[model samples]
Target: MEQITFSQLKKNLKKDTTGFKEIKLAVLGNCATQLLSHALRGYAYELKIALNVFDADYDQLEPQTLDPNSELFTFEPNYILIQLCSEKFQLEFCDLSPEEQESFADRVMARIQEYWRRVEARTKAPILQFDFIEIDDGVFGNFGLKTQKSFLYQIRKLNMLFSEAASKDKQVFPIALNSLSAQVGRDTFFDPQLFYIAKMPIQVDFLPQIAKRVFDTVEALVGHFRKCAVLDLDNTLWGGVVGDDGMEGIRIGELKDGKIYSDLQRYFKALRNRGILLAVCSKNEYDAAIRPFREHPEMVLREDDFVMFVANWEDKASNIRRIRETLNIGMDSIVFIDDNPFERNAVRSQIADLTVPELPPEPEKYLDFLRKSNLFETVSVSGEDAKRTQQYREEAQRTESAATFASYDEYLQSLEMVAEAKPFDSFHFARIAQLTQRSNQFNLRTIRYTESDIKSISEDDHFITLYFTLKDKFGDHGLISVVVLEKRDNGTLFINEFLMSCRVLKRGMEEFIINKIVNTAKENGFTLVEGEYIKTQKNAMVANLYTQHGFTDRGNGIFHADPNTYIFTPNFIQEN
Candidate 1:
């Protein structure tokens, strides 16, 4: 395989935003070998990953070069890539007698294995490590008639050893095989056994593609999150401004230019379906902008498709602020998309954290632009994504109703708030887990549990996993909040895990849940409701949730809410 230059590999690594933490490579050759060394250095610079290049060419070094008393082998790397070639293999038998060759090879293997064992023991600082085996013509030249069989046996043995080692060490040991010569073929000299031995192919021409696949695989194994794209209406949803062009005049249909806008809408809809929160921020009359969505025949997006809508002449920055505040998400989590460059630039300038993509002049390029921006690329989508828009819409309605109420209690009363808390089952486990993962603000413990972990909680009687669906006069906010409660033996209800969707924050959802907990505790004869405020980078909004709900601080990061002092409106349940 042709080798990649250090500069080229570095450039690609820098561009690789695939979110891999570390790159560990093992080179089994002269440490000074320019190509591999350069590639390793480049990767370190580009990916910002810790590079661990192992010098495997023991034969090339002077005898007893890495003495046990020396410091050559003391340094440890996050990843260890072993470049195993015939040249390095010769080092094992260089000073050995004919009868000692087998013993020497065994001893060498044992040492390498032991080193890996130590590396695996240090798992607190996990490292991505791999080995690269180079197939060169020297192996065939040295073994001559037995070259094929010997090479096959060695490869198989090495694979088995690595696989066993990986399982024992709990470290990923991927072996990348590179065939330098083109003379070998499957029918002529190639061995099917090699297929099982090699984990990744070393193709010269498709190195970039291969690297990208590896990066993607690693990211999928880990997980990644990016900003959500908040779309706009009028020229954004279709081709023309709905307020000026009227519903029928908006270019969105199956014909010519209209098809382009339709396609763009379809693209946006697909993105929405994949958990990207779709919100409309159009500078037009509410009814006028929403009319095309309701009455237009060619419209792909409906009124229910959006999470939030800001249809007014107010500054878009203000509307965006409202959306962010209501959602309880940071300004950085949003991406504003508008057809007008001025609007896009305005939001971009005002909200430095908000990501605003340049609007394409032609509708046909909308999808392409979105793809290139990579704003919504993620590892997985939880069920919470599907109902995100509905949740936001419900919050918007709650905000509107709050304006009409005289006092906070009156607003809470008017909400007709119903907090439908249910034990998490298979149907909602995924969403519950997702909320734990993505929800930042309003998260109590900020303990991110996976779906499987949540599912396993059912077996424990002391642990309670419950999710809440809030609905009022405006709409049903599907699965707005989740609370995983743990029962302690001291007659206390411990708030183990608590998270609320950004859409439902400040809508009396938390208050309603607290009231329910208090009532439940009172009925069940519990003394106090205890909670903890686990600090996180994003959940400062709810740092005082327990205190706000009348929880008294009990030092050492613990708070207690008195069940007796809690006041509840008798009609809270009847109204819902």
Candidate 2:
């Protein structure tokens, strides 16, 4: 997220956004929010998203939230943003008694959580709450942290309490303005003069980047985020090429400038630990590229660390395309990192959708530059994420094993794939919510659900929700699919949502799921099973999904089938 000048953002307000994806957002702030609202909408245009922010009237947060019939709810926003400035918070804290200040963090949290619950009670829109940035009045000086009644103590405690609250309630997302303030100097992050004059807390010069950060979180929540990082080996991963430098000559560890590369590896390792897949795309012989990972004692990344390793003389672009195809992810969901400008430009030019970061000339600066860029921000992480690399490695094995079989059906049958479908449970709510937000190409209406939404649907008698998982000889594809059916009064079951991980495509998982849907409808005494295919930019793969599952197209994007007469689709997958 590059910084945009005040004028640049104002000019962006006039750009065309006719076809961009529109997201309804409700903004409630304690200070003037008109500029922030405009900056967000305009910055979103750069990302090809039309952010429709509905800024509430000045200082009307409590009244608008307390009133159920207010315009806030009437707008029906998909997201709700509440920004309460530190400037306001400091003033409020100063007015408190010493006894009251002792519980300042708790008191503030209770109030903030009230807003969250009130918003959730009125609407299911995800709440984005801005946490207070750091502020010290030098009242207690260095001892403020030890003193519970100090502003420094309460402010830090409040941020932690806010994080814990957000963790317990998945509907709440805390935006870290404090972290941003720390990164850019506080002098740049806040404007005392602007606050006094126009009631705007943040500096105009920093609004563009701040707006971009907000949108980044929004993008991740809406199922648009990077999943993989493609790294170039030479100076990118180590100091020199393994082919030319040989095993003993390459610099990777703490002998000299090699510490830089090691630091970079550690950062990438942290990313991998949180569920991002790592892959190698180097221009060297497979043996030479594999040697360092296999034999180098100084190397932090082993051969097993990467899910996909493509080392050949082929053009980097072609290699990247092959990697994308194997992973079953869009090109946009990848970040290509290389120390060589030629390689970065070559790959970026060919793949317009891929993210390529510009590394500083100095190797030491690479990690900071990439970290500051925030290329891999995600809203949630599940246990399934940490095991992602292993799962993909298993997938590669499955693909290689398939080539040995004479027939595709025989290959699938040999794998002994078993699928388990169950009602939505709290244990899998995180993964289920993630699937709804992440799965795109296979999603049939493309409706995203938060964990709170999943919890509600699980208990709602009017809806039938099923979470599906597939396991085979290779490994378990954890929570691969989700199906939500809305029970209708007329003995018909409407398929409200049908989505699955694209990695499990062409494995008869679709057929297995459809058969179960039909059986479930019949068991529940639903005579008719109704569905629809809503076309999206990425979901054309499932445009004819209903028709393929023995559903008769009823025109206008609707389809129907008689559950009593529905024949199960043929597939080798067995129910567990």
Best-fitting candidate, scored by TM-score: 2
Question: Candidate 2 on 448-513: residue-level lDDT in tens?
Answer: 888888898999999998988999998998889999999998999999989999889999999988
Per residue, candidate 1 scores C-alpha lDDT tens digits across 1-576 of 123443578565345444544544433333223344445545454435544545444333222123433222344433344434433454444556655553443454566666555544442222233342433324455563343334333543554565566554434434333221232332322333432343212322333333432343333223334445677776667777777777777788964478877877888788777767777787889988888788888888887888777799999999989877766677766888888888887887888878777756876778776654445544335666766666666676767767887797788677776768777887886677667766777788877665546776755788766678877777776776787778889898888888887666666677777777777677767788888998866778888878777788888679987677776634343323
TM-score of each: 0.59, 0.97
Error of 1 at 455 (Å): 1.3
Give the candidate number with the greatest lDDT.
2
The local distance difference test score of model 1 is: 0.61
Sliding window of 10 residues with minimal summed lDDT for model 2? 1-10
lDDT of 1 at 147: 37
Error of 1 at 523 (Å): 8.1
**What is the lDDT of every predicted structure here?**
0.61, 0.89
Could you tell me how far off, in angstroms, the CA of residue 513 lies in candidate 1 after the best superposition?
3.4
